[model samples]
Target: MPWGEIKDTAAERRMFQRRTLVMLGVAVLLLGVLIGRMYQLQVTEHDTYRTLSDKNRVQVQSVPPTRGLIYDRNGVLLAENRPVFSVTLVPERVAGMDATLEKLQQLLSISEEDLDRFRRRLREPRRPYQELPLRYDLTEGEIARLAVHRHELPGVEVAAELVRYYPHGELTAHALGYVGRINRQELQRIDPVNYAGSNYIGKTGIEAFYEEVLHGKVGYQHVETNARGRTLRVLERQNPVPGEDLQLHLDIRLQQLAHELLDGRRGAIVAIDPNTGGLLALASVPGFDANLFVTGIGVQAYRELRDSHDKPLFNRALGGQYPPASTVKPMMAIAALDSGVIGRHETIWDPGYFQLTKGGHRYRDWKRGGHGWVDLIKAVAESCDTYFYDVAVRMGVDVIHEYLDQFGFGRNDALDVRGARSGLLPSPDWKRGAHSQPWYPGDTVNMGIGQGFMLATPLQLATATAVIANDGVWRQPRLLKDVVGDTPLDEVLPKATRDNVILKNPDDWNFVTKSMIEVMHGRRGSARRASVGASYTMAGKSGTAQVFSLGQDEEYNAEEIEERLRDHALFVGFAPVVDPQIVVSVIIENGGGGSSAAAPVVRALFDAWLEGFADEETGAELAAAGSAGESSG
Candidate 1:
């Protein structure tokens, strides 16, 4: 009876109503939170989300600039750009690089080298979406195969780019140098934004020296891409500035002639336009094709070049240091005359040899018996070693170093010849520091003959000869002739570091010039035979740089020694002997005699230059070509 009386209908109704209302409140609160979050994402943070979405579809790319054209002074193309197809891959777009690379190797039939280089490049620093090259210069069949499978490969594509090409690859290799793939060290130093897509960089010679001028400004583009990073269309574009075209002082005809003269022999020939100091021909024999290096040479090909017996890669004209031998006699003759060490008519008697002080060391003359009585003019003409020995002893090394330095000896005097060696110029102080020995009188005697410690490069010899041809003016040797741009050629080149060597008597220059002429036309001149049929007056001095020193009693027998052990033939001189046009220095490695081997080469060069450049307009042509050539712009 008590339980029945305790039942409450109002309380039960109130409890049900409270539970329903609480559930309704919870649902409304959750709905409101969801609505606010959706509004924040859709309207409040609209820009942020849209930008994030666009980043996936739109991409910015760096466009590499077109490398400049290189031309000879006569408008002959030396270096130009040719388009090629390359296999490229973007790592960010590649889901699995190693797996993707494996796919590419199979599809393109890529070599181990290409794969290896690709892996190496991947490890190197690169931009976010930069295409790393997998294979270069793809064949038509290879391109077709890649296209068929390109859809299957998400991050891989074929790219077209202009690669450096040398039209006269073997002929102009050392003169113009070459470009190759950029390395890790180069990547780090170059501007990250500008060089993003530039893969090649100048490696040596003129290419390396004028890289900034050769490589134009980089451009950019905005492109729309698909999910796999394939470009659908370019949204915006910026054109790249092409590198400036350069007209070099090189004469291809002269270059070809110099190379022909050096054929079947190891040697170098450096020709300079004396009036302008422009390098006409810089030839080093056994040259390699520069085009091989442009797109990255194969391992086997590079190894072959690196290990060749001829050393084709070596720049003999700029780097070969040989004894200038009798070639420097002309320079020394002026040094002796101006320094007052020898009178113009002073005679030095020779009975084939000279002793340092009675019987110390009988330095033998080139001629077996004697030059009889050799005056300054006679000594230079005859290449009388005994006379020069006497003058060298009288002048001493101090005076010699002083005068030779002014003539561009013992130092690289080229304005744009990169990698040239500063050949050793021995001095008393240099002797003390280098060998820890005192300067001996015998050293001075050897210096007289351009033996012992003296060394000079072909460029140095040419530069010195140029001074004589240029009338004691030291115009620095250079390669740049003109530019096809707004910039002046003078402003582009380095300021010539020169010390005009004005002799005490201006007549001394003429006297020295005449003596050198005798070296070509005189009856007793060493190079007289080579000058027999010349239409123009020429001046030259022949020299023999002994590869192996002879003992005091030993005589030189060219036939007995190995060809490599024979004396190196050298000759330096200029043509016409009046307002001279071309100055040349020739060095023949292991050639028997200067008069026989080197003199003929110089004579040929002289004949080619004088005869080819000869005409009524020769003077004007010479002046335009000689006058630190201005740009056509």
Candidate 2:
């Protein structure tokens, strides 16, 4: 204490005062800096920070537009959309996808198919924050379970969407097709921005043809979300534009009738309006329930359809390529008459078979014993193979090819009919390019009878028959009737794209039509039995296509051959000879004889079209279709 007290008292006081002043100065400098920073944050950058805060709570979402509805000519619902609840997940909002999926599985049932579809889609290109469906058409119990655990799982929601539903799935499966979930390949092909929030797309038939018109414009909305990524409210929204409705020429009653007529048979039926090329009915038997593919078909179920011996998926009306058989006789008659290969009263001698020369391969006729002497009308009515064989040789393959092409053979020119095959209309050039061989005389003879190298689809046959009914007018077949949109039906329908079959003699059409009528009502008409109860004039040609060729002298014995190896029965016809109400083509696979099998089928369909279905019968039939559900799965 004595040593410390030695310091000067004045010096100690001065030092304390200096230190206090220095501390005060430093404090004032720090206060100045803090004031500057406060000014910068509160005034200069206020908008930036406010925007950042809003972004954390708000989100922009895409709203998918409603798809179009499809109806038949009679206003029957062919394809419609039914509301379905689905479980969906937003990946970005999820804390941990693996953990969330595991938790979801524990709460409800999830099929391996749904999981596979989800996992596969997750790898595909998609818009930001898109919701992926985990399960579709959830059961009430599953929905309850999901609802109870909704708060436990983040980024999970139950969504309702209109899914494609076909009331008469089996009846219109091939004609109307069905929608399916978008896949990775489709993602690359479709417009990402436009298709945003849309799950399904048309896969085939008219659905695919009019997809652009059916899929309406997308919309947008700004929504406010909570801290937990749950949507609180919509801040702003643009209402989505619903797709336009479509009306088709397809008659639901006719479609059902066609399916019924083809029941228990493997075949196809194509009916069309001759005046306008609208299809009344297009049916392929052993059809599947298109709904199976809408959400997702089960693995086993798909395998069964793919491996079934019946080939239910095959579009026989548009795709089955068989020899046109004697169904082409009328067309050949026109070719022969117009080309001067034969006259209207052309005569030929038949002795049960045709010979190219004095001694050549004898092509046996359907009638083992022959029609003896026959004129053009009698030949066409009796389907005399000898008469056609002679004219085909004179006309040559090129002439035959040219005439057949004019009738829409060897190519698919229908404006809206999809999945049709361009059947072979063999010519010398085609033979050379395809088989690297010259067209043989026998090949030409076979073409005359719609065999050897000539093949056509049931649709093609129907169209050709329609040309006759329309009096040489060429109108491409179409399924679309009218669109309920800004665009009118005429604007939507393509203009005439083909030429009418003109002849040197305009009366040739009348002559050929008369000959075709003879094939139905003439005393020796092949299809006379089918025309027995007809109240109106009818014209038809029955045809039988051999599944296997016979030897020169081999006789056809239906009982001796396997049923599957029997001839394919075919018939093409149009009724009310004057106005020609409807044109139909029927093909039955392995159905023994044309007159016995296909002719009756055509007769029934024609009667339905002309006479119209009874109201009571239609109700009962529709009820049956609804009950059947068209779903084997």
For every candidate, C-alpha RMSD to the true structure in Å: 6.0, 4.8
What shift in Å separates residue 362 of candidate 1 from its native position after superposition? 0.7
Q: Which 10-residue window of candidate 1 scores lowest in summed lDDT?
A: 624-633
Q: Write the per-residue lDDT of candidate 1 for residues 1-633, one digit (tens) a residue.
A: 787579888898999999999999999989999999999989999999988988998888888999989999999999999999998888888888878887877777789987877787788876677788888888999999988888788888899999999988889999999999988788879887777789889999899999988898999898998887788999999988878889999999889878777775888999999988999999998899999998878899999999998899999999999988988998999999999999999898989889878767888887778879889898888888899899999999999999989898899889998989999889999999999999999899989878899999999999998998877888899999888887788778999878788988989988998998988898777777777667899988888898889999998887889989998888898988877999999898997678777776787777777777444243232212222101000
User: What TM-score, computed on C-alpha atoms, does each candidate reach?
Assistant: 0.92, 0.94
What candidate 1 gets wrong by more than 4 Å, as runs, is 1-35, 613-633
Model 2, range 1-633, lDDT digits (tens) per residue? 796689788998999999999998999989988988888888898888878888999988889999999999988888888999999998988889899988988987886777888888788877788899998888999999999998888899999999999988788999998899888789889998889889899999988888888889999899999998788999999988878889999998888878887766999999999988999999999899999999889888999999999999999999999999989988998999888888888688889888888887898777778779888888888788888888889999889889999999999978987798999888888889999998899999999989897899999999999998887998789999999887677766667689998889988888888888887788878777677667888998888898999887687787999989998988899988999979999998997678767777777777777876764354233322321110000
Indicate the residue-level lDDT of 503 in model 1.
87
